[model samples]
Target: MKVTEKTKISELIKHSPETIEVIASVNSHFNKLRNPILRKLLASRVTLKEAAKIGKCELSVLIEKLKPLGFEFEIDMYEDSSNEKINEVIPNQIFDSLDVRPILNQGQDPFQMIMSKVNILPLGKTLEIISPFQPIPLIRILEQKNHTCICNEKEGIFSLFITKNSNEGLENNVLEKKIINKIDSFDEFQNKISTFEKENKLERLDVRGLEMPLPMVTILEKLEYMPKEFALFVHHFQIPQFLLPELEKRNFFMDYFIVEEKEIHLLIYN
Candidate 1:
């Protein structure tokens, strides 16, 4: 069967029960594919196309993933060329910038301020918005207008780059880090994360600013050395919808909290 955006998850699973693991390996949320609640609640209603939009995944990537899982579908190479790449970045790429952290800390909404500034830009200009965290909701709004966004979080700061003339595709895929090293000396829980960050344990594999397959591959590789039972904290622009199932298959448990919608703290453990 040819897989299109409208291909429902239930139909895919019905094609082959074995596909559950196959598709789940591509994302974490799909791990819940076996859950009665999710299956009954969404599997039937959610199509692959809708899932891509919900998970912020690329349609082409989803189609490619299905191929290895006994899903023989026609490949539409040019079908994705028009899409913008939202993950990979060119260091020091020039752009117009706006910082909204201060406005946010003052209990003011920066939306209007940001729009006021962005609206004045020349056509095809790049607008860089720095914030406290990755604004997934905001990006969703911009995408509807044909804008491309590259999201990055560093040292508690989130940087979002929006461009009108986009040349690449979006990379929302992520990984499971293999080297989950902890601080040699345990300090208070609050200080523990800080120490690990300083020790580079947390920085060892920052999947942020990386593209697909690279993200997923990096994560699976890291999971190899990550300690079982000890919590591992990861920062991502958005939830790794595809990677969730792979983590579940590995017997790992995870829950995430968003840091002002700029950065997501994915806490993973056994």
Candidate 2:
């Protein structure tokens, strides 16, 4: 198959399993793809073109590297999107904006950060998503949930203007309304813990739809500064298999419960 800018990383891997080594060898950071968690969360969503940008490698160089893997990219696809300005684009008018490039820079998935904000966005309010590269997969997901969006590319940064699709009846598909309402600060979150410990307050970290390592990292980091009596609550979309062992190693046990078939809650404590 002819490689194009829109060719997803997972498709490339599926088409030719050898492409993984070629992509990883292209840059040190791309080596994260070797991890199953990263591959599962990112590979299906990131395009080859976006992969090159994320890897901080020249498009031409990445294209050349792919040649050995039986994939050939067109010359036009080699033109990096960063150097070109996206013209005639009118972004959605948004008062609130989120810049998740910081999270990406820290080697964490910014997917949930964007979704979390979007979940609570009210009528007539717009959410601007700022990222290092075009977040195509997320845009597609929002589109599925019936959100209208406009995309813009300036220099290397991509901005997406998002608003709930009125035609779709303003449905919040990714996160439940109860969970969105449940979102609170560290202090407020502590007030709503399980009955297992009354004296030991618990903080809630709602990670619904958060990608792999980000959820695990956020939980562990919070645990570091937490009081010995404190517990941590997690609202997740799925079980974090990778985090279970880490919690066990720290002598913390987790209790899981599902609510309304839409949200899963986990309580972690020593």
Candidate 3:
């Protein structure tokens, strides 16, 4: 396959697994690709274009690095277009906003916080996000959800304005209903867990002790290769807010119960 700016990293890796190392060699920022779990989570969302921006390197750098691997590239695909401006207008009335710089400073993931606000934001109303740098992954995810984005940067601080499209009411409502049904009560969660366990179709993972993104990464990796008949029971410190949306995107069924401040049980099935 001929590589282009829009080619997804996951697609490249799937085509040639060696592409992971080649791409990661372009910049130190891409070293995370060496982690199998991180690769699975990020590669699917990032394109060669976005990767170049995130890596703070020229697109030609990535293309050249992968050339030795026998991958073909489009002519002049490395030309810089990062200064192209998006013509989206910011809404006058901001419905909700979040500043994730503090969360990042604390070594925490702000994805859950950001998604929570987005889930309730009304159509035509805007949600503003302030951060230290451009959140390319989050922006990509939101754009996929039918939100238009406009980003501005000043003195190193990034302000992102996202507005949900007025035409997405039906689809967003359906997703909201799905979110409600996916959360099970304690009794319901217990019953499903017991049934799966009795049938020996339950897999267990404990992510309570793991760090911020590790827990999310490990869980997704397990789900990626999970058997069709198996359900995964994860022991987590608190509700994995970020994982919920990802699970929904993957068409996975989930049930969870918060046991206490530091104990949460989540059951994921196909």
lDDT of 1 at 75: 43
In terms of TM-score, the best-performing candidate is: 3
What candidate 3 gets wrong by more than 4 Å, as runs, is 35-37, 75-97, 103-126, 131-141, 150-161, 170-191, 198-200
By the lDDT metric, which is better: model 2 or model 3? 3
Candidate 2 accuracy as lDDT: 0.66
CA lDDT of each prediction against the hidden true structure: 0.58, 0.66, 0.75
lDDT by residue for model 1 (173-252), tens: 22234422223332333465565567555523466666433454566666667765355676665566545545755777
Residue 152 error, candidate 1, Å = 2.0
| Total clashing pairs in model 3 | 0
Residue 202 Cα positional deviation in candidate 1, in Å, after optimal superposition: 46
Please give the RMSD to the true structure for each candidate, in Å: 14.7, 10.3, 4.6
Per model, state how many residue pairs clash.
Answer: 28, 0, 0
Task: Identify the runs in model 1 with alpha carbons over 4 angstroms from their true place.
Answer: 1-93, 165-270
lDDT of 3 by residue, 68-127 (tens): 878788746535543343233443557888888888666567776676677778778888
- Scored by lDDT, model 1 comes in at 0.58
Residue 119 lDDT in model 1?
A: 61
